[model samples]
Target: MTFRIGSGYDVHALVHDVSRKLILGGVTVPFDKVLRGHSDADVLVHSVCDAILGAAGLGDIGRHFPDSDPLYKDISSLILLKRCANILNEAGYAIENIDTTVFAQAPKLEPYKDEMSHKIASTIEISPESVNVKATTTEGLGFEGRGEGIAAHAVVLIRKISKKSG
Candidate 1:
């Protein structure tokens, strides 16, 4: 059996756009501000996608979903995650585990961790237990602490499945 590990991190600036809701891990969290980006800006999902792609040696998210593309405008990161899973499947890789951390200063995320895990697991077609999502604050230390942006980090482990001897 072969295993690969990949780590990813992403951050998006917070904007005062009430029209745009704050989305993380495919769940909308109640917040006054939202992250600004080309896509829906679900930071957690973006990081997770990057981690999965990295594990498969497929480069980063930008390589697959370039921001320059008009088709991905305002696209959902969850969709990107699903596409990533398909990419992994094509490469004969299966998700073993995914661990992630979200950084923010407001709108406490503790309540949404479980849902995030389940959503990610569902998207990847893996057991919910294989996904773990954690939230933390910077203690007023960095951009996330200053409430200027939201960030997430993800580390994923993937296993190459063996083909049956027909």
Candidate 2:
């Protein structure tokens, strides 16, 4: 079986806007600040989508879902993820496993990691056990450490599906 691995990273600044909700991994976590982006700005989902697309030989998320497009304005990152899965399927690829990590300094994410993994797996039509979600702090060394922004990294393993002989 042909296998490919890809990694992706993404970050978004946090803004003090009560009108915006803090969504991470498709789950809304109550926080004073929300990520500023054209979409819901779910860093975890964005990173995962990029990783999958990269592994499948497709372009990055920005190429497929441009921020300049009004159609993606305030769109849910989960929706983008679903489209990525479809793109991979069309390219004759199947996801094997995915690992991801979220970097932040506030609003602890341990409580939501499992849910995040499950949500991502469901969105990609993969087994929950195939996805792993983790979170960490920067120990006060960067934008994420300073709570000014949130970032996430994702790595995915995908394989080409072989056709069955008649």
Using all chains and alpha carbons, the TM-scores for the candidates as numbered come to 0.96, 0.96
What lDDT tens digits, residue by residue, belong to model 2 across residues 1-166?
8999989899999999887899999999989999999999999999999999999779999999999999999999999999999988888889999999999999899999999999999998899999999999999989998999999999999999965233
lDDT, candidate 1, 80-156, per-residue tens: 99999888888888899999999998869999999999999998899999999999999998999999999999999
Clashing pairs in 1: none
Question: Candidate 2, which segments miss by more than 4 Å at Cα?
Answer: 163-166
For candidate 1, the per-residue lDDT at 30 reads: 88
Mark the regions of model 1 whose C-alpha exceeds 4 Å error after superposition.
162-166
Best-performing candidate as measured by lDDT: 2
